[model samples]
Target: MNAPQTPGQSLLEVVDLAVDYQLKGISLPAIRDVSFDLRAGEAVALVGESGSGKTTTAMAVAGLLSPNAAVTAGGVRYRGRRLPIDDDDAMRPHRWNDLSVVFQGAMNALNPVQRVSKQIAEPCMLKLGMTRDEATARASELLELVGISAERGAAFPHELSGGMRQRVMIAMALACNPSVVIGDEPTTALDVITQAQILKLLTKLRRELNLALILITHDLSVVAESCDRVMIMYAGRVVEDGTVADIFNNPKHPYTKLLIDSIPDPSTGKRISRPIPGDPPTLQNPLSGCAFRSRCPSAMSICARDLPELGAHEQGRVACHLYPAPAEARGFHQMGEVTNIMALENLQVHFPGRGGMLSNLFGRPAAHVRAIDGVDLTVRRGEILAVVGESGSGKSTVGRVITKLVQPTGGKLVFDGKDMTSVEGLALRPYRHRVQMIFQDAYQALNPRHTIFDIVAEGVRSLHLVSGHEAIMQRVAKSLAAAGLNPPQDFFARFPHELSGGQRQRVVIAGALAVEPELIVADEPVSMLDVSIRAQILQVLIGLRTQRNMALLFITHDLPVAWSIADRIAVMYLGRIVEIGSADDITFNPKHPYTVALRDATPKVRPMINADPLPGLNGEVPSAARIPTGCRFHPRCPLAMDRCRQEEPPVVDVGPHHQSACWLASTSQHS
Candidate 1:
């Protein structure tokens, strides 16, 4: 391969890099012809779906690739010198001094046994040849640089918050003052607010220290918010590369456009059901032409005959046959009349917390953890109502209560205009048949020992919904076919482990459909699946809701997912519904401060370039055992006033169908 052109004195350059993992005698190519340049103090982001070779490319660059993996072609160069990444001894000097890495999970990356200060000081003492006392002092200063208190440096990893732990990792990465930092999914598995804070911190440090940063992430919003340049990878290849503004605004590649379109726009309440049709090509069994030809919506005959080169387009460099790109837009079908199918009135689910033995002996009443406190919600037939919140916000609890998996401690649950909160024994049997649940982890929810047919048939058998051996089989086959698992007979005998993530989720959905429930409580059903498959599962749910006229109570933490699929949204905060309205009302004209923070924290592609750090919440969610006295969100609310701290706010009607439990809603609305 010919060498690529470099701009100025490139700090780091990757030219036609290729990597493959060897298993037995077979070689599976994980990265192919991946090349990019990073200048001093520049921020570049590698964005793509999971298993799209983003992580593999970063691992290769950092010399952290697995032993089974080998670089087949090209080289990684730092300051025009070829890096011996394959040779550990040769790369040792450049590891931390010239380049460093902040791994994905900070909690798992840090040493739990050692003090954070000691962990941060180790590199300084060993690499920089500093004294023990000097290293300790330097550690404190590094912590301060990341906005952590110097005194907290002595704390253990577990004692610090998620954001603090990440900050400590950043401090450690900067210990030897590395010129370049590669962060591999640095903000993965973090809350939205924490993600924003970390992104802001990374951007701040990049400018302050004049360090080049390579952010490897699946989240496009983070890339748009933090990076100067963007590279979209797919199946081990750089499909698109250009300035952030150029790519996001006018994406030339079909895959790049799909990714941007898939991101649920908080300003628009439209569900994106047009998922890329096929799975990514298997690298081991090398496909002949374009890797994305099977999934491309605008694929031509040439796409299958010849692979497209990463040639320059008007906007940027794109690997596609269709460009100047043709506009390809899709829309969803409208639902029928909205009639309330299920309602929760002043619902409360309080679990009694256990006290010490002394308190028990003294007959002291145990304190209660108000999991769901006076949350009034409704689900209309054929409509998707999403309950969104951070962890421990009681969104899942509400779903459980609706499905009767966990009984509510107080208030009423009305279904089909009938009060069924207090009903028990045989009287409650019908309610169970009318409401079903779809769990988040499809692998865990499904029994490994059971076959696909047995899993789906179990529900029909237990409820006696169908009779006879053949009748049950017919019912199971029908449900399976409805869930997009066509040719049901083919999948009937397959085990849970044998199926893909998307297929397993389909099995779970088939089981729910077997019961023919009027309302389905789906709790983060697609969170574990890939972004491409997530759209498929969401499409299945939306189709079932529209075709079956069933009400769906969708509980999730992802704002974009909620915006994409939900007709109405209920934003939960510390067990209460802070905001409830149509998706448009909640997304476009939010009234509550918590809702606003959530929207702002969500990364989205802005029309113009934004240099400002994304705004983040002040603190983590408070403990459910000891929630704040008045408004539970007041502690971290940006619009919190004295009255907010003093009293619990009443739910005020902010719009036609919008209600917000916020005092500031009365004075000023936050959009």
Candidate 2:
């Protein structure tokens, strides 16, 4: 904890800055007149969905511009001096010493070749002009300061988990104790506990050193909890800017309002979230006037004439024509429907426990662990059925079972009338195409050496019910376009290595669609993407359902996404669906305590983090290798009684299309 203090006044000032990237013969403006200030001990969060140019702005501020990118207009002043964007040599001295960047994605940001200590010490020895011994000592101190052990400093980037690597990255950024610390989606790779830890570390360090933070993130919850000020960006423009309290309380922009309203709350069952539709305008060919005009709910005829100027409203500001004028919202589907695309009757995934010899001898069936114990559900056609749960709640197992990636121990899966339990081999292949799955990790799911065309076309060629190279390529192009890749001709030839994380995911989605699948099982599809692009990919899924009538089984720990997208929500606890209902019923009038706990744990735009969600779903999800007895959640259930430990409660229907598998829900109504 002996890392040197970061000092100085209003640490960094980015005023009227506009940046452009050299593309072929054209210059594409990436950041447009972005202005912000950061002072010591204050955190300014840049909030936006993907392709908003938040990262480009941050990169410019950090002076990490490639030769391809240049500041087209305005400047970044650090403590009253303008940063030299053109000359790297001129910016060298101030780069790490004044403004240091902690990047997103622990997986990619850290070098595979270097160890954690070495990475931290590399900057220390090189940038800070420290001796090896001094650098090592500082690195150790920094690691400790970031809640990592000095003893584990020797671990390589791969050796440490994602969160640990992020902590290492933070430690490296702080190794020099730079005057200004810029965190770019720093907590994106982490889970809630790890996110909390990282945010706490950043806050502690900022306070201790009086350091200024320009935190870039998509999560409003993070902004609300940690940031003092927020700037909402869209398509390279700041649409809204304000104090967190001001913006959340009085969201002026339609995008801002949708962002706030789309968030989920635990006390309420499920909210009718109005997810903003349409993709952000192509940065390469950005729309004239307001970039958001095409997607804006309050889009007026005049909105197309000229870009709306940033107008003051109370304490904050918004850049929308109808802010002071009332206008009708567009592209929101409030009512959700369920029509049974796939059904699982008593779907159970069980593995044997550790009691080998004695259990075998006594013929106790090796003691089933019940990963998806006796779960029955239906995914309606053209509807999103979000399966919400904490980690280890069997939400993922259910997805895998439906995809036939994992064979269920007991159950009948009726996919458009075909029984999954008895289907196998060639017969299974048909069902596989009918219900495809997209994994959370795009890099791992995709072949590294393959081109975007090859990766996406692989599914088309493999599924081969058709013709020649031209025909296959045509299908590939169509699939890619369907998954949101514009001008498919340009993107098809590109390789995965050449694409960004969001682009890679789109390629995967395109691959999933190439088979012309009726349904997609997305296991945290957007969790790995940047905040800006995450919503875009999610909308792509929703749009697919709306346009092409593709059913989606969205399995995620992210409840807000579920609240926003899911038609029917199934709240899983331990290994079973503790609550099942229409999205309205689940978000507005949740009955199961587990459902309530999950809703509470998840952060919406206006997150109430001060209130603990009746204590952390309490205890680890009972091991799938050796699950507990009776009501599967009895060990952790807040309302568990003696009878609950010995007897399982049947799912009770409290209202139309609402069911909760809790003795409380079932018995409370009777009692």
Candidate 3:
């Protein structure tokens, strides 16, 4: 039986919480001395890099820790009542009824065979003892409450879009009316616009239902927008905790400051992303003193001698030796001069759409998925042009076309004023040697069986850039060092699986650099990495650009990241570039409604407690196979006019070297 509640207590409290994972026969400490309180209607964010114990602490609170995890020290409390979290049987009644968790991947958490409604209704029926009809009715209400129609509740998870599936998870989390809800990277996999919508929905539900929300996320921008209080965890300890403004504006801890600085904020209008030096320490043994001391730029002798207590600071608590020392300002490096490297004129790439055998048998013409309908773009040497959009927007397809991975259906691919559209067979060797592509997932991109040396030298040997094994080794070492892997000899013998995610990505970059490519097509390179690690990767790219004058065709869904590094930003929707301009123009003075929507969806790092909800995009990007008539964005655009639906808008120059393919661009210019 659960303990009786005491009055006037915090809605939820975790006092000196510590967790350990049983690896083999050894107990590896994952979370150490994490303490916080969550009152009703409060939203707190557990912010950290991967393996920072944010998720572990949350799982302990929700009594959803894995079988191998043990609460070695401390405990969780609900309304002053101690929870037997480690005891699964004892936590049965409290799970989902009082505390609930919306896992990271909705598809993985939800049952594949069962309907979404049935999954949501299962908790309602089992926990609340509601009849089948009652549960079904409640499920329908919840589905509508989270913006999904009740009629679509019968659809399988695969049938819904990524955004809709995430909504279903939210609805299911609220099925039993749980007072406290824990969202574990709920919006990590979503697009910026979709993420904005989900965050808006979560905030609204938290206020309306008077529920306490705990969000575990690595994205600090998301935290600043949705959370009231923020906790910065490093290694396995809560290094800092304070209000959003206090933490973001005046952080005392080095790790906290570095994390905030690492994030690429488009609103800042400065391309400054400094990565923290060194990697996170391993938890094989209990750490002494400060776990972040090795990586701390301002680490003192005292820090190594003793661990700092979470003492009261200015407006919150911080576990750091430097209590009041302000963070030093860093210099921002400007990108050098740029010239034309490549250009695409009316680029078009189309794949055969899924037309079943019946259509072919009926002698009907097959349809094509217009991945890249018609895009006119340019890449300049020593500059980064970011292509930003949601999935199916065809930004990635443009990169593939440039790399010759995907043959263009029509139009021309020009490099250095030379048309390379029909370049094929052995004739394309020079083009391949000049252009290299870096994929999103580095682990999958690299061969698991090959050593780091072999992987890096593969390009050198294939291109025959250098002769002899000694020359190849020298080239590989140089590339590895350039990619920020110092003492390259140490990693030469290691396999992909042996290295960390950041290290693996660095290896991929090293492989690309071994061939000395003139232009690099980086497609979402930093999306899979942590903030600190991402900063490192971004710095490496910027360094390479500075040293080699290498042009980059950077493609990503993150607008802030694009704005942080790119000299120019291109906004794509459906299969066309809706807006193209300088980063500042695209982010600040957007002419297209789609561009405005994307800018609005980007969460800025600021205090947003009880802030007005974001005006997110209306719906997901339409199917590429079924192209919308006229302007593709008109269907979801808030400022869409009658002409937008009836007539295709022509590209108009809105500013100096800035163009927008929107009817409103002309109207705005005239007005």
Candidate 4:
């Protein structure tokens, strides 16, 4: 490791760093001309899309690049001493002793069979040269420091939740008290409340340890709240570098400005989604001027002929032709008439829990998992209704019931004056033609071996929507174009792997559109996309609603996203609707404490210094099989009272078309 860090000194500096990956004997540029500096107690965020070089740059700095990656130019220096980042053996001594990395996927990064405590202790014993007993004690302390109990450390990775597994990773990263810690999308897969907790923990740790941090993530909201400095990357280069306030307040680069604008901001009223026009440039090609010229709205002739170098502009640095020359700076369409198209009346779906011969012999009762309990909802034509909640809250399960994927154990589903309560098998084919579902993961939902054309044509062919080959091709092309893939022919022959995360999602949307469904059940559609691409996808869905007069049952864990596009919002807690109202009322003037906590947990695109703790929940959601009586959410509710523990609250109408199921709803009404 380098010399001990001095107070208020530069902890790490990377100068003109470049990295290349060997793909089939061809060198592909992953990072080009990246430079940054971090002080002893500073936090910098690398923000961009999937192929934008944020993760690669962070990996290079942490001396943890992949096997095929090579540092072609420049180097990383720690405390004024050069680090052999390219040489794995030479970098070992300094890897965890000075710099550590918390990878993105906690499940994949951790060893499944090993106990979490043993995994955390490995680094301590190996790097610090501590005995087994000392390392074991240190592991317990680290777990406690990360807000996880020491007793839980004895559990295996599979036994923990997503947030707990991530906490274990964080504990492991801080095993040796490293000078710098790099978090690569640490909270990407977590819920809003859990995300807030992790961000809060990292902030607290940074303050206590006085360690510099480099966070690599595409979520600008997270960057706004946690980062001191921001580095915007695009197409293998740093396009903008500045303080958080400078970047968010007055972004100079067109790309940076567009990225900030593309975010789904519920605070703004009735804004339409406008995605960046085109795709990012392919880095494999040699000829290029400005990489963002094709998609930039302010692009001039000079931008196509010459590249803009990173230079000082006002309070920040930006690589844009407009900076040196001049400075200039997802909601559905409302329908004229709205009518109820679908309604759920006291819907309940109870799945039988696992039971075997051994369990029967032991006199164990086979309980049912209450996936959905007493849900009453309605979806209007040409209007979007969003169901928002955490995992296991049954938001997705509600969508499944409406789409007829899962049979409801009890209750009624009325659609277009037809009762679909007990519809199943071949009898449900007609209903399926009018209603379709878009799943969360596009990769898993689609067949990898099939071409884009074949995948889109499958629904059309199966439903007998088109007759001949030529008619089917035309139908597929129309759907693809409607989903925003221009010309459509270019992607027809390509497989799922050939497309980016955003493009793959569009294909899934196209498949859904090919059937020409009047009502679409989208479950976490844009949850996997970058902010820029997410805008495009949301626009496509919203556009469909206007053109086809379609009704959307959007299910997601993101309240802000739902607020941006939905006409109505429903908050779910423990398989029950806790609150329901217009989007504005639900977000701005919530009657339920759960809704209030969720809104507070979401990180905003505003500056906050060592921010105060969020008013989120204190514990995880209870198991469905063993749900608490009285109020299902009472155990984790901050405003719980004696009545809340003894009797379940009845749904009360707080306003016109607004209802809340809380004991204090009567007093909390805005009136």
Compute the lDDT for candidate 4.
Answer: 0.85
Q: List the residue pairs that clash in candidate 4.
A: none
RMSD of each: 28.8, 27.8, 29.0, 29.2
Query: Which tens-of-lDDT digit does each residue in 184-283 have in candidate 4?
Result: 9999999999999898888888878888899999978887878799999999888999999999898888888888888877777626656777788665
Which has the higher lDDT value, candidate number 2 or candidate number 4? 4
Model 3, range 311-356, lDDT digits (tens) per residue?
Answer: 6677888888887322210111222223478999999999988777
lDDT of 2 by residue, 262-294 (tens): 777555675576678888887577776578888
**Segments of candidate 1 deviating more than 4 angstroms:** 1-337, 357-363, 605-615, 669-671
lDDT of 4 at 366: 79
Q: What is the C-alpha lDDT of each candidate?
A: 0.84, 0.79, 0.85, 0.85
| TM-score of each predicted structure versus truth | 0.50, 0.51, 0.51, 0.50
Residue pairs whose backbone atoms clash in candidate 2 = 49-532, 50-532, 50-533, 269-586, 269-587, 269-588, 270-586, 270-587, 270-588
For residue 435, give model 2's deviation from the true position in Å: 1.6
lDDT of 4 at 654: 84
What lDDT, from 0 to 1, does candidate 1 have? 0.84
Instruction: Give the worst 10-residue stretch by lDDT in candidate 4.
Output: 325-334
